[model samples]
Target: MSEPIPTGCEGVDELLGGGFERGVVTQLYGPPAAGKTNLALSAAVETAARGDSALFIDTEGISVDRLEQLASARTEDVEDLASRIIVSDVLDFDEQGEAVQDAEEFAEQVELIVLDSATGFYRIRRTEDEEAGDALRTVAQQVTHLLSLARKHDLAVVITNQVFTDPDSDRARPLGGHTLTHWSGVVLRLERFRGGNRRATLEKHQAKPAGETIQFKITGEGLQSVEDVP
Candidate 1:
């Protein structure tokens, strides 16, 4: 049997069959202010609190101050948790490649690695004139390499993605397309409720079946589980 994975959120862990699967990529996708970053940060904090190290790769210029704020706002103790979490930012694919290598080397001591908004790297690497197809291929290569590294080091991988409206259809979709969905073992979608509350819905899972959606609320103390509203 595969080793157990722990979800940062309590209720989410129960919904995700004990937790996310180890040595696999899990994608968290949502629109702006949809609590994607909040969820990722929560998971990272939980991993660290459990005596495991976690690495956060910030590509969208998520400032150190912002990270500190999130860390401090964690449901768990911040000072204790911050020591176990490391943060890095890369400007392009080349930088990302190097960062991945460094993360692999560090994974010997770290338990989890998170790429906060991986799509940002793709956007930075893509030239204005480049076709979507070419850019996607480049992103695919990088993600594949990272996945390999995660597997080799037995590190759990978490990636956050931005959502976009699919003009051709009514539903929302992740920015990177099929390459992302195919590579990730789990895909979660987050949105805001009528009262500005957050909702975390499991959209897809390759490792196991995710039968129902769950509700979550964010506060100064951090993410808290809520009953699923009908």
Candidate 2:
């Protein structure tokens, strides 16, 4: 059998059946202000706190200062955790591929690699009038390359994605659609719930059967497990 994946949060780890399985790509999708970045940051902090190095590739200009503030405000050993975290930004496919390769090489010494706002990496290639097919193809190639890196290196890959509203369809969907959904081993959707709380629902997973949804809260410390909303 394959090794179990580790979710950075204890509560989440239990829910995920030990942890996210190693050597698989997990996608975290949410709309703007849905606490997606917070989840990623929390995971990175947790990984580093466990003495495992983590690399974060930022495509949306995720503020390093904000990460520092969050780390200092929440973690017990902020300085030590911060020391284990690394950040990179990729502006195009070429740069992104190089970053993924570098990250894979780095993963030999680390436990996790996070692509913060993975979808935004494709924005560099988008034109105002670009066709949907072309955009999908571009994103597919990038996801494929990243997944290969993750598997080859035996490291967990977590990618954050932006959600898009479907005007005609009632169901909410991710921006990259099937290309991303198919490539990923797990797909999670995050959203704000009542009382300003947020929920992380399992939209899809291949390892084991998962329920429709799960709930979590965002505190100044980061995401914490909450009772699932009925």
lDDT tens digits by residue: candidate 1, 50-168: 77888888776665565566667653576777888888878776677677667766777777788887787565445465676776786677667668867887777888887677889
Q: Global lDDT for candidate 2?
A: 0.73
Model 1 lDDT, full chain set: 0.75
Alpha-carbon runs more than 4 Å astray in model 2: 1-8, 73-77, 91-94, 121-127
With a 3 Å backbone cut-off (N, CA, C), the pairs that clash in candidate 1 are none
Tell me, by TM-score, which candidate is best.
Answer: 1
Q: TM-score of each candidate?
A: 0.87, 0.86
True-vs-predicted CA distance for residue 225, candidate 2, Å: 1.3
Error of 2 at 127 (Å): 6.3
Candidate 1 off by > 4 Å: 1-3, 63-77, 124-127
**lDDT, candidate 2, 109-207, per-residue tens:** 777788877777465455354665776686677677777867877777888888666788866678788889998988888888887877777767775
Error of 1 at 5 (Å): 3.9
